[model samples]
Target chain A: MPEVSFVESLRMTLREEMQKDPLVMLIGEDIGRYGGIFGVTKGLLEEFGPYRVRNTPISESAIIGSALGAAMTGIRTIAEIMYIDFTTCAMDQIVNQVAKIRYMSGGKMKIPLVIRTQCGGGRGNAAQHSQSLEALFFHIPGLKVVMPSTPYDARGLLKASIHDDNPVIFIEHKLLYATKGYVPEEEYIIPLGQAEIKKKGREVTIITFSYMVWKTLRAAQQLEKEGVDVEVVDLRTLYPLDLETILQSVRKTNRALIVHEGCRRNGIGAEIACRIQEEAFDYLDAPVERVAAMDVPIPYSEPLEKAVIPDEEDIIQGVKRVLSRN
Target chain B: MKEDHQIWLELYRMMVKIRRFETLTGELFAAGKIPGFIHLSIGQEASSVGVCSTLRPEDYITTTHRGHGHVIAKGGDVKRMFAELMGRSTGYCKGKGGSMHIADFSLGILGANGVVAGGFPIIVGAGLSIKLRGTDQVAVCFFGDGASNRGPFHEALNMASIWKLPILFVCENNQFASTTSFHYSTSVKSVAQRSIAYGIPGRSVDGNDILEVREAALEAVERARKGEGPTLIENRTYRLRGHFEGDPQRYRTKEEVENFLEKDPIKRFQEFLKNEKILNEEMDRQIWQAIDSELTDAIRFAEKSPYPQPMEALRDLYAEDVDPLFQRSLA
Candidate 1:
């Protein structure tokens, strides 16, 4: 096994998929010559040339709409919307056209497309550049939303998403691009809608994903020293959520603490908490707790931004609060 | 290009077929046979038929909400089109997409979009796909003068020009975008003029004349196939009918509608065919009767077709792994 950064894993997976499938192509802003804003698509232009590795103009709607069209016609396209927040410009293409074309066409057309974008609030990039918007796509039907927490998961899930016969919203955490994880020398694919138990315990279950998974793991380690065994469940996919694993974890632990970087109001954590109570209510010894970003725009000030987003302390406090009730 | 007698007769026949089909559609909508609102292309047949006539079955086209003429002219099966409009299982989209979303990929008919300027970007993609595959096939985007004002129009035109993607941007300047006239909404004298900003060749033609429209389409399609990039064509035409069924004639004066009715593409084509000695009164009557019979058979086929089972709504939502998790609660 070779350890690689999340960005490298993505590039490796893209290279392998494009080599294996002639229909696989890349189209987005600065993805060709500039090697992508985050350098995730570096050196691909040299390998694949400009035809397959296309660098499109700064037109979000056209980028997504063209990707949707190409996917429908006969190709697997990965369109990058540099910042996830910029997706608002192409909302109609993603929500109305790409997401509904399969259902609307009655399965006659398939949009094998992956819209890769980065979202998170750790950096002091302010509100527009930093925000977790998986909840928006998760709310839509006919779309598979995948958020990987590690390099191994990112590479595998992205390969799977590319081959999927449906549109996928593959959201990357801006902060997780440099995170290193062990990826196999051989190719592998982590199926979407599957949860991974990063660390298992018996006292409480901390459910999180993407960057929040790292925070929860750190908090879980601190809790281990204090003799509180906290189980961490990293939801690799948001929609088609791995509810069975979540319910099983909650059943074993008898307490659930949902953590996410998105605002607390109507966030993905809220849905998880609701489902935990609805399906596993009897298994809970205490009410389900949620640790999420404060309901405010990500501030420009570093301290204010840090204060708004969930941290390890918040996850630890949330777990202790749930444990205190029991 | 000089069209022969056979080509002129074929054009006339197609124009008559589209006119009769649209008229019957209006009648069916009034009789409560169709479920949704229908945008009839009563006066825009020449533009659709003429442009489609120049392309092969492998060439692609993206149409607007008012896209019945385009689909029919592009060799779509009349029965399946009627079935789709009637919400039957035998329809092109299995009744899931009613009037605004009919498509036949085998005939290279990309789905009609409900958005005003939706077809622009999709056509760019189709053109891009053609370029990537190293094929000479071209993609045509049929939109209105109103759609030219949209962001996608700018984005698609600029992208297609810089990349030199093989696409034909056909703007059916039918004088109205819904109830608003082009004069009120558009800044330019003609939509084709905007093509200059993107560094593409732009031309305007008499959309009612089938031969003229066909000639212009031939040049553009040939240029696209030669990898000369996209061309903007402004077909100066009008919508004789109201934007949608049940729309009162409050937007435009009745005189304006009557004036456009005088320039009806079908009648003009019939006159041209007559002058060219290709079609006589007897032949015109026979063609009308044949088209009427064909439309009647299509309606009967649609009426006899089955409605999709209610459970079908859940199907086709995903291609694989129908996710029993969501279906369990619904069941």
Candidate 2:
């Protein structure tokens, strides 16, 4: 295993998949000669040729629609939406068309397309760019939503998503691209919907995903020093959530704290909390404490933004609250 | 003359199949057997048949809400299409896509769009793929005159023109966006005129006249195959029925609808075939009979098909191989 950046892992996964299947191609804004906005597709254009590494117009609708066309036509298209917030421009294509195509046609047509985009707060991206809309996609039955926390998970899960028959939405956090992690060389796939136990413990189970997973791990480390052992569970995929793993972790700890970057109301954490109370009620000693962004839209100001989104301190406080309930 | 006769007979066959399909769809819709809105392609049969006839199975066709005609003309499986409308498990989309979103890529017909001008940008992308891959395939985007005002139409045409993508922008000027006539929404007299801004060849043909539409589409398809970039074609047609089934036509005169109905595409094409002395009435009758039988069989198949099972509702929602979330349970 080599220490690779999260973006490199993503690139490696794409490179390998593109080589394996000629039908696999890249489509998105700035994905061609200029590489991606974040350089995740850097050097891929030259490696795969212009036909394979396509740079689509700024129209998100076109990018997504074209991806659907290609996917339906037996091409596996990995289309980038630039940023998750820009998804608003192409919601009709995403929701009404791509998500519905497979089910509507009675499985006669399946869009084997992967829509890759960057999400979550951190880049001073303000309200539009910083929001986490995994829950919105989760509500859509036909879509598979995957959000990986580590380079290894990012590469493996993305590789699996590319080869899958149905449409998969891969959401990457803006700040996690540079984060380094151990990723094994050669091809691998981290199956979607399976929760990864980043660290094992007993005092409390911290359930989080995306960038918050890293924050939760940091809180776990700090708590360990305080003799309060905490278990951190990273939900890499949101839609087909691994409730069994979550409940198993909750059963082991008897206390649970749900955390996510999205708004608390109807957020991913809220869904997890409800599920825990439904299935893991007997295991929970205290109520499931959720560490989530406030109900208000993500603001631009640094302090206001910090106040809205979850941080390590928030996770720490949530952990303490869960333990104090005992 | 014999060659012309054969083509005319084939065209007639396509018309009969589409007509029967559309009529059956209307009946099914009334019976509540079809899900979602069904935009009948009854009057615009010639426009779809003419354009799709000029393209290959590999060549692409993007459709609008009025898409059954295009699908049939492009050789899509009618039974599957009807099954889709009925939301059956055997439908092309496994019952997910109802009447408004039928698609068959094997026949080169892209999915029908529910959004106005939604197929415009996609056709450009398909053309980009064809041209980039050096394939002779060309993409045809079928939209209504109302879609001309949509942002995707302008964006796609402009980009396709600039990039020299092999796309045929076919605007079926049905004259109405639901209730509003094209004249009311569009600033331009002819939607074809907008092609001048993109610097691509632009032409307007009588949509009801099958020969004229075929000639226009043939030239555009040839030009696209020759790497001459995209062409904008405005086929001026009319909507005989209301926008949807229940729409009360307060906007347009009944006389206008009646007048357009008088020049029925199948009738006009049949008359043209007769005047050219290429095909006899007997041959036309035989072709129509075969298509009608086919349509009847398709309807029967759809009626017998079962609705998608509730347990399988989650299946194919995401691509089976890549969707990591669903497979997590297996692990």
Candidate 3:
């Protein structure tokens, strides 16, 4: 077993995948000689050469559109948008073209494409750079959105997404890139849409994903000492949500709390909470609760940014609120 | 003649076929047989047939909303295309994609994009794929003058130029982008001249002349095959029909359309074929008859084809098995 940082795990997987399959190519801004802005694709260009590790111009639409074209035409592509906020520049290509091409073509086209981007509010990067937009992509029917919380999850889920013969939006958190976790040296793939129960308990179920998973896990540990048992379920994939796992956890605990780093309004929590109520309403001993970022533009100030996004305290309070409903 | 008489007649036949297909499509839409809207390249047959004449079946092309001529020229099956237009299950996209999104991957025709300049970037990817695969397959992107104003067009051109991707950007400057005239909407006087900004060779051609379009496309396609890079070609033509069927067309006058009717590509190619002795009235009549019968059978096939079940909408949305969550949410 090897303990690797989230960014290292991603780089290792990309290198291994590129070595295994020549068709697997990386394209984005500064992904080649400059590596990536987050250093996730560092040294990959030197390893794979220029053609496979392409450095693209600041053309988001072209970056995504070319990825779509190349993927369908027998080249698997990993298109990197430097930031999730910038994805709006190429919204038509991502939403109209990449997402719908397979279905629109009657399943005649195979889009082995991965759009890797990062989003969160902890970086103090302000409104344009720090907002989480997984909800927008999740709303698209044809795309698969995966947001991993740990190095282990990131490595395994990325491998599955790249090989999945469909378009995948592989979302990463900027804050979690340096976080280290145990990863086995042997190759193993974590299937998308499969939720992992990070910590199991019986009192309350805390369901979250991406960076929120870490905060929820810590809250669960503290709640254990406070005589309140808590369960944590990390939903690695957002679109084809692991409803079964979520429902099972909620059914077992008879209480549910959804947490995410995105805005509370129409965020990932809204959909997850709705699904829980729809599926496990009878099993729930209390109403479902959600802890999410405030519905405001992420400010550049550190205190304001921290206050806007959900934290461990928010998750802890959300758990107490759900438990108090009984 | 360097080219055979049969090749000349074949090009004329393709142009006529596109002309007939577009005319029939317009008629059917007016007759209320077709569902959804359609954009026709009624007067741009020479640009499509001429450029496509230089491409192999394995080469790639990404077209625009006004893409029927390009698709037909690129060897798309008329029966499946008509079936798709009629929203039949036997169509190219199983009725999911209509006239604006028809695609035939077997013939290397990437789907026609519904967006104005959506195909530019996608065709760049196709060219990159060709280079990676180590093949000489060039990718042609067919767009309108209006599309040149889009961000993707600029981005795609810059990328294709730097990478030296095997791409042919055929701009069908039909003088209009829907209601807005190309002259008013485009900043440049000619779309071809803008190519110098991206360091690519470009030229404008008389889009009504099939020989001229074909000769320019031949040289460009050769450059792409030899890994030289992309070329921008502005085909100066006119949209004989309105942007879409049933358009009020208040933007342009009837006299304006009638003026371009004299310069119709199909008619011009027919005259050239007649002068070259490659075709006569009888041969032209036979070609039309053959195409007409084929279109008639396609209509019959589409009419007989079953409409997809409502639940079938959920199918093919994903390459993987339909997620239970998807079904639950829809339910």
Candidate 4:
């Protein structure tokens, strides 16, 4: 086992996948000589050459659309949109074309595509770049949304996503790139739609994913000092949702608190909270609580941006509120 | 243009098949036999048949909403198309995709896109695939003047050009984007002119003339197969029918419709074939009769085919072999 940065895990996985399967290729803006904006695809172009690792124009629609078309044929394409916010430029391609072609074609088309992009705040990138928009893709039926919290999860999930027959939205958090974790030298596969219990506790359950998983873990530690036990469940895959794991945790803890970086209004929290109440309503000691970003654009100023997004303190407060009930 | 008599007659026959098939589809829609709305390529047969005649079955094509003609020309089965339109299980999309979405990947027909410029990016991808696989196959995208104004159009053309991908951006300038005419919507006088910015060879032709359309398409296809890159061709044509069946069509006057009706592509091709002594009145009548009987059988097949079970909707959204957890969630 070796400790690898989150970005290395993804780069190594992509390189291995491309080596294992000749059909795998990468295409996006500044992914070639300039490397990816996040440097996850830094040396891929040189190793794979230009044909396999293409540097495309500043055309998001074409990048996604062409990826869909190539995937319809035999190629497995990993298309990179620079930011999750810019996915709107290719919304029709992702929402309508990529999502529906397999169904529309009646299983005649096999789309082995992974849309790789980064999303998150705390860098003060402002409204256009910092918002978490996975909910938009999560709402689409045909897409599989994967958000990994650690380098280990990122490596395994990305390898699985590359080989998956359907289209997958492989979203990465910008802040998670530098985080280091031990990844096994041997190949491993973390199947999508599975939740991991990051920490074990008894009183309350904190359900979160991606970068928020780290925040929730820290919050859990902080609460432990005050004689509060908090359980953390990191949802690796958002779409299939791993509701069974969530229910089991809620049942044990007798309370649930959903935390996410996306806005509280119609965010991932809302869905998780509704599902918990719907399925595990009888097991609850308190109503499912949500701690998420304010329903406002992420501002550029540090304090303003901090005010907009949820932090460890917010998760702690949310858990206390859930425990304080009754 | 120098195609032999049999090739010319075959082109003429395909044009008639498309024209008659579209006419039958219109009738079926009017009779309430078809469920959803349909956009017919009645007058734009020359562009479809002519361009498709230049490619092999392995070559790819992505067409617009008014794509029945392209599908039929690219060797799509009328029985399956009608079955799809009738929402039967045996259709191309197994009733999942109606008139707006029909595809047969076996023939390299990447599905007909319902969005205005949706096929542009897909076709570019097909071209990229051909280049990556070291195949000489070419991908053609048939869109309208209305589609050329969309964002995908700009992105697709630019990307295809920089990569030198083998694609043909065939614009069936049917003069209407639904009710909005290209005259009001399009900034350029000709859609082909925009190709200049992409550094590709582009030309506009009389879309009603099968010979002219074929000649331009042959050159473009040849260029693509040779790995020279993409070409943009604007087939200046018209939508003799409304954008969709049951459209009130208040945008254009009756006189305008009547004016274009006289320049119908099928009629013009018939005249050209007759002038070349390739098709006489008897041959022409026989062609129509053959197409009519074929369409009759196709409609009957569509009518007799079973409708898919309602539960079938949950299937095919992803591959059957996906995680059972995802499948369970779908239900």
* DockQ of prediction 4: 0.80
Q: Return the lDDT, model 1, position A245.
A: 94
Question: TM-score, B chain, candidate 2?
Answer: 0.95
User: What tens-digit string does per-residue lDDT give for candidate 2 at B25-76?
Assistant: 8888888887667788778888999999998998888888888899889988
lDDT of 4: 0.92
* B324: Cα error in model 2, Å: 12
Identify the runs in model 4 with alpha carbons over 4 angstroms from their true place.
Answer: B1-3, B321-326, B329-331
TM-score of chain B of 1: 0.97
Candidate 3, superposed: residue stretches over 4 Å from native = B1-3, B324-331
Q: Of the candidates numbered 1 and 2, which has the greater lDDT value?
A: 1
Q: Can you write out model 4's per-residue Cα lDDT over A187-286, one digit (the tens) per residue? A: 9999877899999999998999999999999888899999999899999999768999999999999999998999989998888888888888999988
What are the per-residue Cα lDDT tens digits for candidate 3 across A251-307? 888999999988989988888888888878899888889899999999999999888
The prediction achieving the highest lDDT against the true structure is: 4
lDDT of 2 by residue, A191-218 (tens): 8678989999988998888898888888
Query: Best candidate, DockQ-wise?
Result: 4
List interface RMSDs for the candidates, in order. 1.5, 2.9, 1.2, 1.3
lDDT of model 1 at residue A267? 93
Q: Each candidate: RMSD to true structure?
A: 1.7, 2.7, 1.6, 1.6
Q: Which order, best to worst by lDDT?
A: 4, 3, 1, 2
